[model samples]
Target: MTTDAGQYDDQGEVPLAGYAALASVLATGVGAYALVARSRGVRLPERLPPWDVVLLGVATYKTSRLLTRDKVTSFVRAPFTRRTGHGEANEVLDEPRGTGVRRAVGDLLCCPFCTSAWAATALMCSYTASPRLTRMVCGGLGAVTVADWLQYAWTWTQRTAGQ
Candidate 1:
């Protein structure tokens, strides 16, 4: 959504809001997708490049997390593993120092790390008020999130970095 000036807020004057919105929506999508993919054990088409996964995860995660809100943040924080003993809610997005988000986003080399990083970034980016972004976030808050993440998982296996 652009401002009264007909300028896309995020395109320049206020990019953070847009970015945050993107992040929030993607977070919901990724979280829901991760949960569903884990349950269905969906398979990817092929192996993606080593860095491709990371790049994709980073790009997607950062894009998703451009927003921030308790509900949205909480939704984005959905845990990959069902093992509750692993950590707390607030801790889900918190990864090793420079390992998950930055590292995952940078090397663009690992799938698991990149996936987790993307989730974290989404949760981190959520912090604003954009109906478009919020609506997008809500849209993915349900099964749609699951579907999107599953798509991402499939995307992961389609990389070609190994060859």
Candidate 2:
């Protein structure tokens, strides 16, 4: 059987092994959650309420953006990413660096869309473990998300008024 690394070796610089490793970690986390829940006799909710879904969605968006782009969090990504430039709203633009796992992690850390899945998974797990706490945390992030949009809207209004 051809390994992912060897198979993708001739296909250019794709980090198949690194991607596999990341996938493994995600799978392990999910599997562990399932096992622990089962062992503890914890029941899965049939479905999340629409309001909860909306709150979680906003929280995921903000959390992913903070992790992937916020300047304040650059230290977390600095080891794996190189600062490319500045982004709007106190965010930084970064490009993945290094090879294999390092580059893969950098890619994940630099792309909000890519990080959203991880963030959502973590948030969902937290919600499952503690609904009240998760809702509080999500509500705070959701509020921040709304405040960010309001800030942008206010800036736009001021710009238009000045014009």
Reference-based TM-score of each model: 0.22, 0.92
lDDT of 2 at 71: 89
State how far residue 70 of model 1 sits from its true place (Å).
37
* Highest TM-score model number: 2
Q: List, residue by residue over 1-163, the lDDT tens digit for candidate 1.
A: 5456655545443334434554676668867766765577654435445544444344454344322212244333333111122222222233221322433222222223344555544432331213245335544443344565677777677765445
lDDT of 2 by residue, 24-47 (tens): 999999999989988987787888
Tell me the spans in candidate 1 whose CA falls farther than 4 Å from its real position. Answer: 1-12, 43-163
Winning model by lDDT: 2
Off by over 4 Å in 2: 1-11
Clash count (model 1, backbone only): 32
